[model samples]
Target: MKLTALKTMAATVALGVSMAGAAFAADLRIAYTGYSTDNTFWIGVAKAAAARADEMGVELLDLTASSPDAAAQKDAVDRAINMGVDGIIIGSVDNRAFDASLDSAKRKGIPVVAVDTGIEHDHVSSLVQTDNLAAATIAGGYIVDQLDAGTVLILGGSAGHQTGNARRDGVKNAAEAAGHEVIFQICDWQDACAYETTVNFLQSNPDIKAIFSAWDPGALAAVSAASELGKLEDLVIVGFDGNPANLVSIEAGEQAATIKQDNTRMGAEAVSNLIGLIKGESVPAFTPIDGILITSDNVAEFK
Candidate 1:
């Protein structure tokens, strides 16, 4: 009986040591899947979030879709699940394409926080993004004031994506309500695609008075296309996401304006929310970061 007690005490000490080692080594392992790093906006996000993760002493697993590819994003989710992540924070490629993977994570009791886009699943515990509808409304209102009922070329992201669709609908709805016709040219938010599409559309509709891209890169592409045609001065070109490149264009009188999203803050806040969730704290269902309009009048401020 003394030998049995001794053996039991040894086993208990071993278990306690093992548990303490695990607690000391890895408090949590969280994963983050971002949008295309090709966009400088997302790059800013990644850098800021990584800094926050480091400060929190948490291991951040970074995964990003190259450029709004659902398959790639889904693969990333699978990898995160397979890694047994404590939680996942994702800026979904399409927001609607991760149903299966998210469902799998849910079954495994892994929580998810969405950033920059809304996934239509109850599994997502929190969402952090700009007020896209309000931002796009501002864009539309600006366009309405700048042009007098001329067709506005709506160059932007994939129409199926929630953030893309929200921006599109917000602008389209507002622009249409003001008696302006909107023709959507979805380009998956690719700069080259925006350039080519703008060139073709302008060739066919030289009367187009304004161009509004949902993101700044597309705006930059539109500016280049118009400048190449010696029509930069004639078009009212506006974009979202106040990238420095877009600000430079606005300064150069190529693009007219852009909306600046606080992407860095959004990224940091996502990490904060994830950490809070892990600590058994209730997080808000939605978190919003502010955005601003960057034109020649205020571009210098952002710069």
Candidate 2:
């Protein structure tokens, strides 16, 4: 009887040790959603996140919508929830569209993190984003200073995107407050639309001295449009998102400036925060990353 009891006690101890090891080796599943996979910015974020997940031995599944559409992004989040991921990172297409989905995730005890664009839902455990408004304000101030109160054309993304509206409002408020006339155009974050809109604006408003685009691709398109219209030299084009193409444009004196957001860092930080939450750790609800202004004066530093 004593021998049998000793064997049972030893088996219980061994089983407990095995269970602890399994818990430690459990894979963390993550789901990510964003606008489109084509943009260099989003691509960098995805690559960085994937690399980190691999290093940590975590399972990551990326989901991208046809475009920056709210409904599509929400569907992706819903799918992640149904699949029972440990955590989720959302690049919200529209800030308000993911409230219900996020709420559902929270109900299921899964943590949600927002990257690039923030969501309005209270369930979002954390947000990692750049200071977009501050960057736009800098761009606006630079344009006003260079043009000396001339007409400034503002090219923005889709109508309802929070990032788009924030940037547009920042530039418009700054320029208008400084006694400069602001003309706003919506390109829906499409390069082709930006190109066409820029061409039409240039033809109609010959006196427009500067153009501020919300992203590098749109700015590059505007630069091409200006060149086609023989107004490249006369137009001062500023943009956000310090993409490699925009940096090249800055070096070539084609674009006046761009705002640099550390997309890789943002992605890595989002993953780290979500992992912490999965482990039942505390995380901040919002994490605002800084932005740097890139121009010919300091473009070499970034390059």
Q: Residue 61's C-alpha lDDT in candidate 1?
A: 87
Task: Itemize residue pairs with steric clashes in candidate 1.
Answer: none
Cα lDDT of model 2 by residue, 153-216, tens digit: 9898877777888789888998899988899988888899889989998999887899999988
User: What is candidate 1's TM-score against the reference?
Assistant: 0.89
Whole-structure CA lDDT of model 1: 0.87
Each candidate's root-mean-square deviation in Å? 6.7, 5.1
lDDT of 1 at 219: 89
TM-scores of the models, in the given order? 0.89, 0.89
